[model samples]
Target: MGSPCLKTVGAPSLEELRNSPAFPKSEDFMKGPIAVIECIEEIPCNPCETSCRKGAIVIGDPITNLPRIDFEKCIGCGICVAACPGLAIYIKDYTYSDEEARISFPYEYLPLPQKGDVVQLIGRTGEMVCSGTVIGMQNSRQNDRTTIVTVAYPKNFFDEVISMKRIKNKS
Candidate 1:
């Protein structure tokens, strides 16, 4: 097994992240929303597995094993999106629109972005990629205070946009 996920301040290398089997195939991704787990190194975590009601995510045996997603079983409900303690899990809907794709990620910050708000989409690194609209937001006790913000952007940016930052004040 590889070393633990303690390198680079928990920021996974995109090259390494793409190597994980958790990424969905083009056909599967274009069909609908699916979970894209970027959990790289082996770590002691399994919230993604337990939160998946469809048994799509499994971190069997060692609790430190990296979580894996069964694209066939994942319904793209975004349940694991907020349950992940490492903030590694994300939801991607390539077919959100004819020209746009939706990307949902866990956000833990005050003054959360509200629906209809335009936010700056950021890449894996902290660089701003493009502007996206806050199409949806999920917050509940079950989410453990982690808000799942869904943003819609150009389909071509599916791989470039992973997270976003609110540029407006809370409503």
Candidate 2:
């Protein structure tokens, strides 16, 4: 016979999350374009829900089932990148001035790229399709180790560009 030990988990409180940059500010995310989170892992995660800062994503009761992103309030800031532990959260602004759309996601790897840098675009399955540009990158203390990378792509492929990679050239 053995003693039953309690599991220890360090989940962030509602108040401590306020200072997080990934968290928006209020219940005002943005309208137009929908973000699809493909990382489907059930863990103690509220980053996606709290990432919005707009009350857009709601885990509600279970703390899983993927947070429902509210279109209207999403500002397309891509703050969820730093918030999601499974690297599931991303932003898709399909209505980026009608002609073009922007996709923002988390990127943590070697050699951080600067703005205007072109890189290989990847999908949910980790397959490369096209090339994209590094429009923005957010690396703050609050984001922890996650780096927010915003990529600009054609409106047609807005659904394809979830992330980017610099595949060593393979020459």
- Model-by-model lDDT, in order? 0.83, 0.63
- lDDT (Cα, tens digit) per residue for candidate 1, span 1-171: 354333754566666776776766678786698999887777788888888899999899899877778888889898888888778888999888899999989998878887998899998767789998999888878888888898899887888798996455547
> Which stretches of candidate 2 lie above 4 Å from their native place?
1-35, 39-42, 167-171
- For residue 57, give model 2's deviation from the true position in Å: 1.0
Error of 2 at 81 (Å): 2.0
Those runs of model 1 whose alpha carbons end farther than 4 Å from true positions after fitting are: 1-10, 166-171
Candidate 1 structure, TM-score to reference: 0.88
User: Which tens-of-lDDT digit does each residue in 112-161 have in candidate 2?
Assistant: 77889988887645568688777888898889888888878777675556
- What residue pairs clash in candidate 1, if any at all? none
